[model samples]
Target: MRLISSSISLATAAALLSACATLPQGTSRDSTNTGLDVRTRYVGLTSDAEVAEILASPLGEEAAVRLALFNDHTLRARYDQLAITEADLRATGLLPVSDGARTPEAGIALPVLDIFLIPLRNKQGITIPERIEIEVTDHAVALIADVRRAWTRLAVAKQAHNLAKMSENIARAAEKVAVELADKGNLPADELVARKIAVANAEHAVIMAESERREAREDLAGLLGVDLMGDWFVHNADPATIPADLNAVDMQAVMDNSLALASSKAEVARVGASHGITDISSILPDIDLAVSAERDDHQWEVGPSIEMPVPVFNFDGPKREKAEADVRAAQYEYAHSLVVTANRAALLVRERDAAHKLVKLLNEQVTVAADQAVAASLRQYNAMQTGVFGLLAIRENAVEARRHQLQGWQRYRNAEVAVDAARAGVILPLKN
Candidate 1:
């Protein structure tokens, strides 16, 4: 009786889920003991008002990241979806044998052999939680990258547009000079007309550039999940580098944090448990116990009865083979993830370094050349050594050079963001 009671208690304890999962808030932030990626940090907002307040302020790169982490409805919905796993636990429906049979039974939680099965117990206890939390970290990494890249584009657009406006001023000045030369008959009719055409092109370019700037701001705002109509502002154009903490990059860290590997590992646990259940079902006999009390011609009888199913055909063979195959498949999937992650990490590192060098080269050399070009052109025009068109061309080239230089800086910053996300910290490695 004590043994049966203990078994009943065990089964009940394993299968109840009263609430859904949520992001850890407050002081428990990023607690690594749960097997989730340690680098994922989030702050949950209590209401739409808090999000509004953040949006009201000048949103910096880091602030934008924080808002997206907590404010995005799609992300929150994904976190809530983990609760669906609880439904699977409930599907057994307490297994209460309410029909009046010889065996009168009542138990805690419920007594279902499958729930109490060794394999299922292990999966419910460990693997499911690990898999869900892997997704938490995965989503966070992707969202943060989005914030960084969008913020960079917004900043670059504003800078580029301002640069374009400055170029227009130079074009306008060239047009004025052409007007003066034409009045004196020193400049040809075609040359003055060409100067007017140059001014017109520069003005059109500024308008297009401004339109792009607004669109970039809108995109950045949308990612932040602020009110669509609210005014947008950026606190930092350049995203700060997320420094790596490890003395050396460890592949193990990424593997531990990979969602894909976590899913496969969970599958392995589930199948291994299924394999155990099948093996037990084939080998062990099912014992049915019943007790009854009755008055038959003033005679009372109450005793326990036992019945078993004979093992005619062993059922574990095909199931065992299938479980073995599943295990092999999961192992191969894990191996593939590792290889892909390593290759990705190497590629991001190379591109980041190259991008950094390219941006530096543009800043150090191109800007200087552009300045000299403008100065020499101005000197030549004043000395009448070059025509108005020649002077305008030099100035136009300088402005275009500046535009490319700004774009190069934006690309370098974006590359750094990619590398940072790809690194995912040693605490949260890209899972192989």
Candidate 2:
């Protein structure tokens, strides 16, 4: 009788403990423990009014990322997955309730094996939420990279447009000089026409540059989840500088903070726990403690009863086999993630260094040679050793070199951004 009372007390204690247990919040802001690459400054933002306020000011890279993180509906939905996991976890703690009025005899049945399996079940329950949190972190990190890439594109577009406008002005000035030479009978008619053609080409380049700038602005606005109809302004900040040393990036930090690996590890833990629970339950018999009270022949009969099923017919072979298979699959997945992450980091670093070298070559050798050639051609034209056509050709070559240099700088900046993104455990797709 005392043992029956003890068993009933234990069951009551478990119910009370479940009622008191605190569950994780449903929102990513509270539930996500994995650190983001950028500090989430505006977490749990409630309204579009905050987005409007940020947009009303000059929008910077960080501000754009914050708005996207706050406003992305998909990311918020992913966070909401935790609520379902929490519900399942809560169900694990509650005992089955039976109708009390159906029978005059009443009993409380407790699964004795659950006392040993509950911890493993709870641990398995925890891994699912952890995996969800890691997935949320991955999405946030990827979104940050997308915002930064769009920001860089906008900055480079502005820069390229300004350069094109300046080149157009220089072309007009040269056309004026050719007009003067034509009036003095020193320049041929064809040479003057050539100068006009050069001016026309420069004007065309400016138009193209302006179109590209507008497109970049639209792309940025799309990523920010804001309509392009507003008077919101994006600040024309210079793109990030090329990284001087790829060696400075900490590979260990990449390994430690990788969202993909973390998620896989959580999966492994979940399945491993499941396998343990299944294996243990299969080997041991089901032992249930039942306390009953009954009235028979006008007398009260009360006692404690033990109900256990023998394992003669079924040893849970199918369940144990499935659990073991699941554990093996998870372990394999974790190993694959580990290898992929290491190789990806190495590849990004190599590509970044290569981009840096290309930019440096363009800046030092290509642009410098074009400038030197133009200077020599100008001196020759002044000394009557070369025609105005030769001078124009040299100047055009210099303009083309400058355009290439600008593109090279943009690519280098993007490469640097890619390395930074990979360090945060997300890879940005290669942009054309």
Candidate 3:
């Protein structure tokens, strides 16, 4: 049996598919770099220099984003995925017969049987560009989000850990004074005990913060598709001072950029557009029309035939139902992404705003007051107006205030990352 569409040959389809193996538009080196930043791709630097450049200068948030876009293994995988989607699209356009690759239809019958068979009707599906558009957008957004999220996590953890080190140093200094006073019989038993406890607590906090920092770095490594064995320094930015104008957030634009909802919409479009031609064995299902030639006992006859199914009990009922169900499922997912993600982005913005306010309060009032109190206590202790234990106690309160400030900053950064992810499902123009 020889079955094929009459319009396109197998070689032509393979050539077309081969020509499209490169990365899709947005995910290409240029487009991806453009989305992350304004600078053009680094053409002059060798790979080592590029790594040195990222490590040499304190890698800021934007730079880290660029680094992820350029170097992350998963981002490369996404580009590979686009090629795969193109391959699938080309596969659909090839001859409908499964054996099109090994054996081409030439109207030749088997020599042993001396008979020829050919499909009367054959139809080919041409892929619409919109079928793969959503995937391209979604993958680009995912790359951007993952890179920033990991970078922010690592940066925030480093900030908290640095503060923890400061607190630990202060606590250790206080413990040294307490031990001296206790040995000289100048400190009370309870005061010495409290000083020791504070020292132990501060040490534990530093240990925990260090662990948190390492975990954050590991997360970044996972995003970059690398192991965390090498020394990597992340440049930290004070996010509390970074101006993110809430009023500037384009809610409508963000919604429009959403790749998730767009993907769902594309799904509905794909299913609907393909409904007419999906089933191959139906006359009404974009009937496969074919021409056949046969020789019957030295009589040559040429005829046109259609490989259509009679409208019996199963007249594309299951296929139509399946397509409808797919549309419904996609619609639900889009609705959830729209309503839930939009609200979620709004809530995160609110949290970031609230955290900013708290950071302001801690920076201006609570931390300032704690610093003054500690300074006053230090002076009093020098003049014998306050005991060493009293100074240590005030220092503990000061450390606690600073810890709160660190928390506020971390919360603000985390909220910023979340908002970026929320903004992803919406489509952004990929400037080529």
Candidate 4:
């Protein structure tokens, strides 16, 4: 009975000890940790009036800028790349191997027999993070360039929309005048039909302009991680004309200013130089304490951990060649981009100069046409030598002259925008 009670007590104690050992290792709650929720609110449906109000509000420009910041798929993808690189950086800091152990015990009454046990552990150094960092830095520079490119495109779209709006207004005025003359029978019915056709054409222009504006807005919104259909307006100052003087710009100098290509070359050279070095370390044996009835024995052992690659079969020959080729390719691309940009700038400058000259000539023509039409109308009206048809014809000529002048101005503005974009390496403001 006493032996049975002792066995039961020992079992109960062992069960309690096992339960304690099986408990979780850490506390469930921590003061510094907080749950994160990434839900975003979308803008509600808005009317034209509401859109106008939103545009007037300060939030509209904020939203526009935010859209530029967030909605870009390229920029967003870069962010993900940055995250992946960061994780790789963390992983690189960790050692490649870790320690582990196991133990076993048994009761026996045999003599002249013994059991042996083995323990194992491993340690190695990691050095790939440094290389990863260099690559990631290069990627960051490229991301900045992408952002600038997207912003320039958005600005261009807005300017185009403004030009289209001005054209629409001119078309509307012409249509109104044509309708009035036709109603009075001073103009042929076909003239009014032509005017209606012009109205339809002008409406189509407006639609196209709106479509472009929406596309730009959506692109910017996507970059910002915002809803593309959100009510927002861009408030920018009127675009400035390109300067008349571009003779001082050296095309060759601009072409040599590529930092990305330079960085890539430098990194490829550095990594190639370090490719042969391998990480190696050694581990000191550990001491274990034990209690025994008579005495205790201690043993020590030493081991080396080597992490060198065997160059007999693979010496990174292929990888080094690839890196050298990449450097050459990057240099070529940088040179090419510079040449293309400079040539485009030169062409745009010439085009702008021609457009300015044309606009000047058209302005003078409009003035002369206006005077001639007015003089003709006054003479006919004073002498009663012409009917309403003659007067209406003179008026229509003046209106047409004005329309031509508007068109010349629009063309000149567009040419100027192109010049500005080329010169500044970015998009210019809209010419309202």
TM-score of candidate 1 to 2 decimals: 0.61
In the range 226-252, model 3's lDDT, one tens digit per residue, is 447766677774644745444445555
Models 1 onward score TM values of: 0.61, 0.60, 0.63, 0.40
The best candidate in terms of lDDT: 2
> Can you tell me which runs of candidate 2 are displaced by over 4 Å?
1-50, 83-128, 179-193, 237-247, 265-335, 358-402
Name the weakest run of 10 consecutive residues (lDDT summed) in model 1.
Answer: 3-12
* Best model per TM-score: 3
Considering lDDT, which of the candidate structures 2 and 4 is the better prediction for this target? 2
lDDT of 1 by residue, 147-212 (tens): 778888887788788888988998898889889989999989998998899889989989999998
TM-score of structure candidate 3: 0.63
Candidate 4 displacement at residue 333 in angstroms: 10
Off by over 4 Å in 4: 1-166, 241-260, 263-432
- Per model, state how many residue pairs clash: 3, 0, 9, 7
Task: Report clash pairs, candidate 3.
Answer: 121-288, 122-288, 257-425, 257-426, 257-427, 258-425, 258-426, 258-427, 259-425
lDDT of 2 by residue, 193-253 (tens): 9889989999999999999989998988888889877887667643234544545667655
Error of 3 at 231 (Å): 3.8
Q: Give me the runs in candidate 3 sitting further than 4 Å from their true place.
A: 1-46, 81-132, 225-227, 237-240, 274-337, 426-432
